[model samples]
Target chain A: MIDLFLFGIFPYIALVILIGGSIWRYATKQFTFSSLSSQFLEGRLLFWGSVPWHYGIIVILIGHLIGIFIPSGVMAFNRIPLRLYILEGTALALGLLLMVGLVLLLVRRSTSPRIRRVTSTMDIVLLVALLLQVLSGIGTAVFYRWGSAWFPQTATPYLWSLATFSPKVEYVTSLPLLMQVHTANSFVLLAIFPFTRMVHMLSIPISYLWRPSQIVVWYRRQAR
Target chain B: MDVRAQVATVFHLDKCIGCHTCSIACKNLWTSREGAEYMWLNNVETKPGTGYPTQWEDQTKYQGGWEVKGKSLKLRLGRRLGVLSNLFFNPNLPIMDDYYEPWTYTYEHLFNAPPSSEQPTARPISKVTGKFMDIEAGPNWDDDLGGSPVYARNDPNLADLSDAERAALFRLEQLVFFYIPRICNHCLNPGCLAACPSAAIYKRAEDGIVLVNQDKCRGWRFCVSGCPYKKVYYNWMAGKSEKCILCYPRMETGQAPACFHSCVGRIRYLGVLLYDAERIEEVAKSPETEMVAAQRSLILDPKDPTVIAAARMNGINDEWIGAAKKSPVYRFVKEWALALPLHAEFRTLPTLFYVPPLLPIAASSKRGKYDLTDGEFFSSLEDSRIPIRYMARLFSCGNEEIIKTAIKKLWAVRTYMRAASVGDISDQRATSAMSELGCTPEEAREIARLTSLPRWSDRFVIPPYQREDVIQQLTSPIGHKAQVGFGSNVPVRRGP
Candidate 1:
C-alpha cells in the first residue's frame, strides 16, 4: 500500500500542484515571479554562493534527464570498468560541489543580518529541504555505489512508467532507503517549486541574445 | 526623416537656489513606499561634491552609459554575452553602501519613554534590516558642500584641473559651489533601455519617456549599473528596478511633473523637441569633443516647414509641433545657445540641458570697499570662483571654449539688464558687451524676463498628450475605461 501510494499517487499529486500552481501564479500574480536577489544588500558572499550553486545543480539536473532519456546509452558508456569509475567519480565531485555551494548560501542567509531580514520562512524551508535532498543523493552514491550503471536499469524504467501514467512499484521499491529518499524529495521540491524563488529558473532570458539592443514601444501609430 | 517629438527640459542653473523642494515633492508623490525609502527621483547636488550615489560621474568605477569604439556605440556594462554571464552576479552593481543605507528614527521612544533625568531621544534604525544603526550618510550627504574635504575634493569632474587651480578652488577666499539638480535625462540612446536583458525598459514613441514595464521586469538589475547618472534604483522588496517615470500619469493629464511643478527657484523649463529618430545611434557615436554639437544638431528645428511636415507624417500631431515652436527648452538650448547638456561625453544624448551658473566672482575687500581684482566693469571671466575648466568637464566634455561662450553670453545679459534697471553701468559698455556675443539688447531683455520672471505657463509648456487617441488605437475606449488609472490593482509584493 505504501509503495503504491508513494510511487503512483504522490507523483501525480506533486505534478498537478507544480504545473497547476505555476500557471495559476503566473496568471493571477505575475509580478511576484522573480529571483528576489539579495546581492544588492550583500553581494560578496552571494558571488561565492550563487555561481557554484547554479552551475552544479544545472549539470546534475541535466544528468538526471540524460539517464531517463538515454538509459541504454549510459549503460553502454558504463560497460567498461574504467568508464564507470570516471562517470561515478565525476558525479560524486559535482554532487560535493553542489553541497559546498548550498552550505555557503545557507551560512550567508543565516549570518548576514541584512540577508536574514529579507529571508522568508518559505525560503528557509526550501533551503533545508534542498540540503536534505543533496545529502541523501550523495549518500546513495556512496553506499549503493555504481548508481550511474544501475540508475538506467531501475530508476529510468520507474520514471518512464510514471510518465506514461502507469504505476510501476517493483523497480524503485527494491532500491535502498537513501535512493528512495532522493526520489521522494525531488517530488517534494516540485510540489513546493511554484511557491518559492525557484520559479526564476523558468526565466532564463536566453532570448536576449537575439533581441534588438534597443526597444522602442509605440502607443499610437508607429514612428517612421 | 523619421521625426519624433520629445518633451525635454532645461534647468537655468543661475536661478537655482539649492533648495530641495523638487526632491521632496517627487518623494511625496511617487517613491514614498516601503522598498523605495532611499530613492530620490529628483535630487539637487552641489557640483563639486560627490552626487547621490557617491562619485557617479566616475565612469571608470561604475562602467555605465556607453563607450564609443571607432564608429560604433556599446554599453560600458559589456556586450550581450557578457551581460548574460554576469546576470547572476553583476560586478558593477552599486551596493547599498554606495548609495547609503536608508534609516528612520525610532520616534516612538520620544513619545513613550518613561520620565528620565536625561532628555529622551530617538535612535536611528536601518530601514532595510530594522536594526539599530548609527546614521553615517544619506541621499544628500554632501549637499551645499557639506563634508567638502571628503566628498567635494574627490569630485570626478575635478580630475583634470591643474594642481594650482585645484588648490585655488579650495582656498577660503576662492571657495565656490553651485547646485545641480538632476532627474533622469530620458536619453535618446538610453543605456538603461539598451542594457535590460528582458527588454522590459523601453522609450515611448509618442513622447521620449523611458519606462520600465513592471510586469516584464525580471530584476536582473542591469538597468541599475547601465545608467551613468545612477538614476535607476533597484527596489529590493519588489525585486524590480524603478526610476523617475517623469510623472507621466500627471503629464498625460496636462500637469507638469511633480519635481518641475514644485521647483522653488523656478529654474525648471519644459517643452517639446522634435528630433530625427533614425540618427540616434549616429549621434550617440560622435567623438567626445563634438558630442555637444552633434546632440544640438539632432534636435530638429520645429519652425522649419520641412521638419514640421516630417513630424506630422510621423504622427506627432499639430499640438506638439506648436508646443515645440514655443518651447523654452528650444530658446535656451538652440536659439540663445546658453544651455548645455550635462556630461554629453556619456554619449547618451541626454534631453535635459543646464544653463551653467554664472557663479559669484572672486572679489577682495580693500579699505572696507569690495574691489573686483580684475578691474573690469564685468569682472574677467577667468576671475569667476568656479573654474571654467570644471564647468567644461561637467557640460561640454572638456570643451572650455563652449563653456566660456555660454558664460560670456550670460554675463552680457546681466550687464544689459543692469544698464536698463540699475543704471550703475553705462549703456555703451553693456551694448558693446552684448554685441561681442552677437546678443542684441532686445534678445537680452527676453532672456532676462524668461530667466527671472517666467509665469507657470511660460515655464512649463506641457504638450497635449492626446492619450485618449493613443489608447483607442490599442484597445476599445469602452473596454479600457475600467483600467484607466495608475498602478496595478494588486499591490506589488515580493513573492506569491
Candidate 2:
C-alpha cells in the first residue's frame, strides 16, 4: 500500500504543487523571485561550486531525457561498443563532478557566516536530499553498468504508463533499493521546488546576449 | 540637434572647506541600513590624495568605464557575454576591504561591565562577522592627511604630473589642496547603465539622473565595476544594487537634491542645459585629450532660436527652456567658462563640473607695511602656489591652456570688482584685463554677483518636473487608497 501511494499518489501531489506554487510565486512575490545569488558574499567557493554543478547536472539531465524522449534511437546508439564506452565514461565523470561541487557548496554554506545567515531550513533540507539523490544515483550506475540499456526497456514504459494514467508498477517497482531511493528523492525535490529559491531557474535572463548594451526602461511616457 | 534640457551642477572647489556635512546628510537620508552602512552616496575628497575606496581612479585595478576600441566604444571591463558569465564568480568586484568593513561599537558591554576603578570602554565589533575587531580603515580614513606621503603620494591622478610639479605640491611651504565633493555624475554615457545584466539601471528621461531599480537588480556587481567613478554598490543583505537616486523623490516634488541642498560652502550650482542626446556615444568616444571640449560642444546654446525651436519641437516646454537660459551651471560652464568637468578622460562625459581653485596671491608684509606688486595688480600666473599643471590634470586632462583661460577670467573679474568698489588700482588695469580676456565689464560684474552673492533660488533653478501629468499611466494609482503616495485622481498619457 505504501509503495503504491509513494509511486502513484505522491507524483501527482508533487507535480500539482510544483506547477501551482511556482505560478503563485510568480504572481505574488515577483520582487523576491531571483537566483538569491550568494556570490557577492563569498565568491571564490561559489566559482567552483556553481560552474561544475550546473554543467554536470545539465549533461546528466540530457542523458536521462534521451530514454523517455528518444528511447529507440538511444538504444541503437548505445548498442555500439565505442559509443557505449564513451557514454558511460561521460556519465561517471559528470556524476563525480556533481558530487564534488555539491560538497563544496554545502561546506561554503556551513562555513561562510554571511552566506549562512541568508540560508534557510528549506535550503539545507533540499541540499541534503540532493546529496542523497546524487549518492544513490552514482551507486546504481556503478553497480549496474548498463542501466540505460535496461532502463529504457523498463522505466520508460513505466513513465509513459504513469503519464497516460494507467497502473504499471510492475515495470519500476522491482528495481533495486538504490534506484528506488534516487527516484523517490527526485519527487521530493520537485515538491519543494517552488517554495525554496529554486524557482529562480525559470527567470534566467539568457536573452541578454542578443539585447542592446544600454537599456533604458521608461515607466512613464516620453511625451508630456 | 536633438535638443533636450539636462539638469547639471557646478562645484566651486575654491569655496569648499572639506566639511563632510553633505556626506552625512546623504547617508542619514538614504544609506544607513544593515547592508548599506558601507555606502557613501556623497563624499568629499582632498585633492593630491587618494580618494575613498583608495585610488578608484586607477582603472587598472577596478577595470571600469569604457575604452575606445577600433571603431566603437566597449566597456573597459567586459560586455554582454561577460555580464552573463560573471554570475558564478565576478573576479573584478571590490571586496569589503576596498570599502571599509561596516562596524558598530559594542555599547552593551560597557553598560553591563562589573564596577571597577577603570572606566569600561566600548569596543568596535564587525557588522558582518559579529565579533570584536581592530578597526583599521573607514570611509574617509585619510580625511585631512592630504600632505602625508602614504595616502597622497599614491594618488593615481598624479601619474600625468611631472616630477617637479609633483614635488612642488608636496613641499611644506607650497602645500596646497582643495576639497572635491563627489556624487554620481549621471553621465551622458553611464557605464553602470550599460553593464546592468537585468537592465535595472536607467537614466530617467525627465531628468538625466541614473538610478538602479532595486526590484530588478540581482546584486550583480557588474554595475559596481562598470562605474568608472565606483558609485554603484551592492547590498549583500537584500541582494540588490543601490546608488544615488539624485533625490528624485525630492526633485519630483520640485526640491533640490539632498547633497546640493546641504552644501555648507554654497559651492553647488544646479541648473539645466539644452543638449543633443543623439551625439552621446560620439562625444563619449572622442580622444581622451579632446573629451572635455567634445562634451561641452554637445550642450547647445539655449538662447539660439534654432536650438529653442528644436527643443520645443522635442517636447520641452518653454518654461523649462527659460530655466535652462537662466541656469547658473550653463553660465559658469558655457558662458563665463569658469568651471570644468572632473575626469573627462574617463570618457563618461560626467555632468558635474569643478571650478579650479585659485591659490591665494603671493604677497609678503615686511615690517608691517604690505608691499604687494602694484603695477601687476595681481599675482602673475607663474606666481600661483598651486601649479596650473595640477589643475589641468584634474579638469582638462593635461590641457593647461584651458585652466589658464578659466583662471584668467576669474582673476580679471576679481581685479575688475576691486577697481569698481574700492580701487587702490586704476580703472584702466581692470578694463585692459577684461579686454585681454574678451570679457566686458558688465560680464565681470555678472560673474561677481553670481559667484559671491547668489540668491538661493538662483543657485538651484529646479525645472518644473511635471510628475503631475503621469499618474494615470500607473495601474490603479489609488488602489491602496490614502496609503499610496502617488495616488492621483486625474488621467495620464504614454509614448516612447
Candidate 3:
C-alpha cells in the first residue's frame, strides 16, 4: 500500500506542484525568479563550494536523465564488465564530489554571519533534503552495488510504468530499504522545489552565453 | 536623422564654491528614505584629492566603466560571459569603508548623558550597524585640504604631473584646488544600462534621462560596479539598485532638479539639447582619443532646418525645439565650446559638461616687474596656479589642446564682459581678444550673459516632456494631468 502511494499518487502530485507553482511564480513575482546571490556579502567559501557543486551536480543530473529516459541504450552499454566498471567508477567519483561540495556549503551557511543572516528557513530545508537525497543514493550504490545494470530493469520501468497510468509497485517494492527511501525523498524534494530558492534552478541564463551583450529594454511605444 | 533632444547640464567649476547645498537639497528630496541613508545623488568634492568613495577612479580596484579595445569600447567587467560569471559574486563592489559607514551623531546622548560638570557631547554612531562608533570619514572629509599631502597628493589625476610638480602642489604659493560638483553624467552610452542583468536600467527616449525600474531590480549589484563615475549605489536593506533620477518629478513639472535649483554658486545650467540618436553607437565606438569630439559632434544644431524637420517627424513638438534653441547648456557646451565632458576616457559619452576653472596665474617673484596683466582674464592659463596637465586629465581625454581652447574662450568672454560693464579695459582690446580666441564679439557678449548674468528662466530651459501622448493610451489625459510624478503612478516600491 505504501509502495503504491509512493510510486503512484506522489509522482503526479510532485509534477503538478512543480509545473503549476513555477508558472505562477514567474507570472506574479517575476523578479524573484533569481538566484538571490549572497556571494557579494560572503564570497570565499562560495568559490570552493559553488564551483565544484555546480559541475558535479550537472554531471550527476545528466547521468540520471540518461538512465531514466534512454534506459535501453544505457543497459546495452552496461552489458560489458569493463564498461560497467568505468561508468560506475565515474558516477561514484561525481557522487563523492557532490557530497564534499554540499558539506562545505552547509559549513559556510552555519559559520558565516552575513550568509547566515540572509539564509532563509526554506533554504535550510532545501539544502538538508538535497544532502540527504545524495547520501541515500550513494549508500544504495555502495551496499547494493551495480545500480547501472539493475536500475534499468527495476526503477526505470517503474517510472515509465507511471506514465502509462498503470501503478507498478511490484517492480521496486522488493528493493532495499535505502533505495526505496532515495526514490521517495527525490519525489518529495521535487514537490518542495517551488517553495524554496531551488526554484532558481529553472533560470540558468544560458541564453546569455550566445546572446549579444548590453541589451537594454525600453518602456516606450514607438511608431516605427 | 533620428533627432531626439536630451536635457543636458553644464556645471561651471570656477563658480562652484563647494558649499554642498546641492547635495543637501538632493538628499532631503530623494534619498532620505529608511534604506537610502548612504545615498547622495549629488555631491561636491575638492579636486586633487580622493573623491567621495575614496579612489573611485582606481578602476583597477573598483572595475567600474568601460575599457577601450582598439576602435570599440567594452565593459571593464567583461562582456556578457564575464558578467554572468561574476553575476553570483561581485568582487569589485564597494564596501562600507570605501563610502564610509554612513553615520549619524547620537544627539540623544547629550540629553540622556549622566549629569556632568564638564560638557556632555554627542558621539557618532553607525547607521548601518546601529552602534556607537568612532567617526572616521565622510562624503567630503578632504574638503579645503588642497595642500594636504595625504589627500591631494594621492589624487589619480595627478599621474600626469612629475614628482617635483606634485610636491610643488602643497607649497603655500602653488597650493591650488577647485570644487568638482558631481551628479550622474546621464550618458549617451551608459555602462549601468548595459550591466543590469534584469534589464532594469534604461535611458528615456523622450528626454534621455537614465533611470532604473525599482520594481524590476533584483539587486544583482553589477550596476554599482558598472558606472565608471560610481554614481549607481546599492540599497542593501531594500535589495535593489538606485541612482540619480535627474529629478524627473521636478522635471515633469517643468522645474529644475533640486541640485541645480539649490546650487549656491549658480554653477549649473540645464536645457534641452537635440542630438542625432543614430550616431550614438558609432560615436561610442570612436577611437579613445576622438571619443569626446565624436560625442560633441552628435549634438545637432537646434535651429538647423533639417534637425527641426527630423525632430518634428519623430513627434518632438515646437516648444521643446524652442527650448533647445535657447538652451544655455547648448551655448556653453556646443557653440562656445567652453565646456567639456568629465573623463571622456571612460567612453560613456557623458552629456554633463564642465566649464573648467581658470585659476589665478602663478605669479613668479623672480620676474620682479613683469607685466602681470595683458588684460586677459586669469592670465592665459599658461601661468595658472593649477596645472594645465591636471585640468586636461580632468576634462579632456588627456588632450591639452581642448582645455587650452576652452580656457582661452573663457578668458575672452571675461575680458569682453569686464570691458562692457567695468570699463577699465578698452572695448577695442576685448573685441580683438575675442576674435583672436575664436569667439566673435557677438558670441562673447552672449557667453557673458549666459555665464554671469543669466535670468533664472534663461539658465533652465525645461522642455515639456509630453507624457500625455503616452498617458492618453491608458486613461483620460486631463485626469492624468491632475496626478503628477511620472513613475509615481506605477508600483515603484518593493512588492510583498
Candidate 4:
C-alpha cells in the first residue's frame, strides 16, 4: 500500500502539478506576444521536433491504448488478429523515426551554441522526462518482445483496477520491473501533463479541418 | 439570376471509421512535402481521448484563433511572449521526446531473420523519446463518457458485471453516453477571422470556410493565442501558420473534402447556404434568447424561393441543394435538432453541427431504489436529466437560451452550406468576392473577363523564394541535409 501510494499515487500527484505548472507557464508566455511587428525567429529545431515528435507520439499512444484496451474476443473480429501485427509494427517503425527526429533536434539545440545559451534548465528537465519515458517504453517493448507473452491479460486487469481506484500493486509488480517502470513513468508524465511543452500536445487540430479557404491579396511593402 | 456560390461540408461522426483514409488522401494531395509531414490537416480522434495535436479544444491553454487588441493585426501567441513570459515559455515548444519517442525495427534484420512460431520479436535500432508522454485527457474529458454505450447504459463507471447485476445497476444508476464526432465549425463570425493581426485570415464570402493567407502571415502567432480551439499550427520552419483550406480545390471541382468523402460511415454532407453577414454582430451582442433566435434567423432556408434566389445569385448550385436535402446533416441539424455547435459563446458563429448519438438503455438494476413502483423499473431516460449546462456554456451567448435557440440557427447554417458550390456563382457575387479579397474593380473585372482561363494560381503566393525557403527550413533544420536558416555569415564568392 505504501509502495502504491508512494510510487503510484504520489507520482500522479507530482505529475499533476508539473503538468499544470507547465501549461500555466506556457499560457502566460504565449499571452505575452502582443505585437505584430516584432520578429522573433522561431527555432527550426523546435518546429520540426514538435510536429514529428507530437504526431509520432499520438500514433504510438493510440497503438498502446489498443494493445491495452482491446479485448482478446474483439481481436478475433474482421481479421483483427492481423490488425495487431500491423498496428504494432507500424508503431514500432514510426517510433523509431520520431526518435531519430527528436535526437536530431536535441543535437541541433545543443550544438548550436546560440541555441544552447537560450536553452533553459526547465527545458533540460523536460527533455529528461521525455527521454526517460521513451527509453523505458522502448525497453519494455524489447523485453516483452512485442506482445509474445499475452501481456494484455495480465497488464490490463491491473489497469482496470487503477481505473476503479482499487489498485493492487501486486498485479503491477507481477509484470517485469521494466513494465512497472514504464507504467509509473507514464503516470508521472500524465501528472506533469498540463505544465511542460507537453501541454501543446493537447492542442486540437480541428481548426485545420474546418478553417475557411478565402484567398487573400497582399500589397507587399517595398523597401523604403 | 445570381449564380455565385460558397462551398461547405458536414461530417457525420457515425460514418467515420477513424481509418484516416481522408487524412492520407489529403496528405497525398497537399501536406506530403518535407515541411508538412508533421501536419495532419485531416485527423480523426476518439472523443474522451486527447485529440490529435493534443488539448485542442481549450483555447485558454493552446492559444489559437484571433485576438482583437491591435488594429486587428495577426500574430502568433507563442512568439508574442513578454521578456518574463519568454523565461517562463522556455523552449515554448515541447521537445520531440517530450511528446513521444519514435522507434522502429531494423528492416534489414527483420528481412534476414527467420520468424519464430510467434511473430518475430521486433527490436529497436535507434530510438528517440521512446515512451508515451502525458497530455492525454481532452477538454470534455469529464462529460465525453466514451466507450460501448450499451454495455454501460446505467452506470457512469462502466464495469464488468453479470447481466443480472448490470440490469440491477441500471435501475439505480440509469446513465447514458453519446458519441459526438465534430469537425471545424467554420463559424459565421470566426474568432480566427477577427483575431488575425495581419488581416491574413478571412471567411469565404460564398460558403464561409475561414482560411489564412500563407503569404500574408508574418508568424505573429496571435491566432495561436486567440483561437479557443487551438487548431492553427505555426510552421516555425516556414515562419508562417497553416490551417485547413477546406479542400477548396476539391470543392471547386465539385467534390466533398477528403475526410467527408472518405468517411466510411458516409455521415458527411457538403453544400452551401447564404447568411446575413450584416446582422452577425447585432445578433451576437443581444440577450441569450434574442441571440439564439437571431442566430437561427440567419439560417436561410434553401426551400424558400427567395432564399434559393439569393443563394443562386451567390453561385450556389441546385445539385448542392438537392444533395443537402438528402444529407444526414440536414436531418440531424435542422429536423431532429439533436446536433449543436461547439463553443458558440466564443461567438465566431461556427457552421459545423453534430447530432449527439442516442444509445439504447441498459436493463434495470435492483428493482428501483431511486424510483421503484411495483415491479416496473423507473425510466431514468429523461433527456432533461442530462445536464446541458456544458452545451449552454459552449453556445449560450451569455445565457442558456442562446444554446437553446442556436440549435435551430446552426441547423439553418448547415442548410446554407449544403447548397453553396465553388465558382458556381453569379458574376456579380464573383465581383463582390474580388472586392472583399482586396482586388481592384478593374482587377476583378479582369478576373471576370478571364473566367474562362484554364490555368490560374490556386494557392496563395509566398514572397519570392519564400515557398522554397519554408520547405527547406521545415524539412532540414540546421544539419539535417538541407539547412534552412538565415545565411547571413556565408560569403558569396564572386568571380575574382
Best by lDDT: 1
Give the DockQ-based CAPRI class for model 3.
acceptable
Write the residue-wise lDDT of candidate 1 on B61-147 in tens digits: 999999987667889998899999897789999988898898989999999999989899999999999999988899899987888
Q: Judging by TM-score, tell me the better candidate of 2 and 3.
A: 2
Poorest 10 consecutive residues by lDDT, candidate 3 chain A: A211-220
Model with the higher TM-score, candidate 1 or 3: 1
DockQ of 2: 0.37
User: B1-496, model 3: which lDDT tens digit per residue?
Assistant: 8888788999998899889999999888777764467778899999888887888877888887787677666889887778877665677887656777577887987889898898888778777656678877888889988436777788899999988777777776567788999999998888888888767678877788898876466677888888989999876544667898898767876778999999888999999999987887788777656766888899999999999999988877798899999898998888888899998888788989999997767644445554545455456565677778888888988888888889988887887888988998898988887887767878877787787888789889898866565542333223333222243343223322
lDDT digits (tens) for residues B1-496 of candidate 2: 7775678899988789989999998888777666678889999988777887888988999888989889989888776787677665677787777778889998997899999999999999888778788888888877776436888889888887789888877776556677789999888789898887777787866568888765566566688888989899877665667788787667666778888899888989999988998898999888877877888899999999999999887778888899999999999999888899988888887889988887686455557666555336667898786677777878997888888999999898998999989897689988998999899988998988988899889899998877655542333322422220233222110100
lDDT of 1 at A203: 81
The DockQ-based CAPRI class assigned to model 2 is: acceptable
Worst 10 contiguous positions by lDDT, candidate 1 chain A: A215-224
lDDT of 2 by residue, A1-224 (tens): 87787787788889899999889877755556556667766878998998888778878988889888889987998989899888777887889999999999999999988778667787788788888988988898799878777668877887788899885776667888887788778889999998887766775767667767655444455563
Model 4, range B384-456, lDDT digits (tens) per residue?
2233343454334335554444333332222222224343344454444434344445443332222223121
Best by DockQ: 1
TM-score of every model versus the real structure: 0.96, 0.90, 0.87, 0.45
Q: Which wins on lDDT, candidate 1 or candidate 2?
A: 1
Looking at model 3, the pairs that clash are none
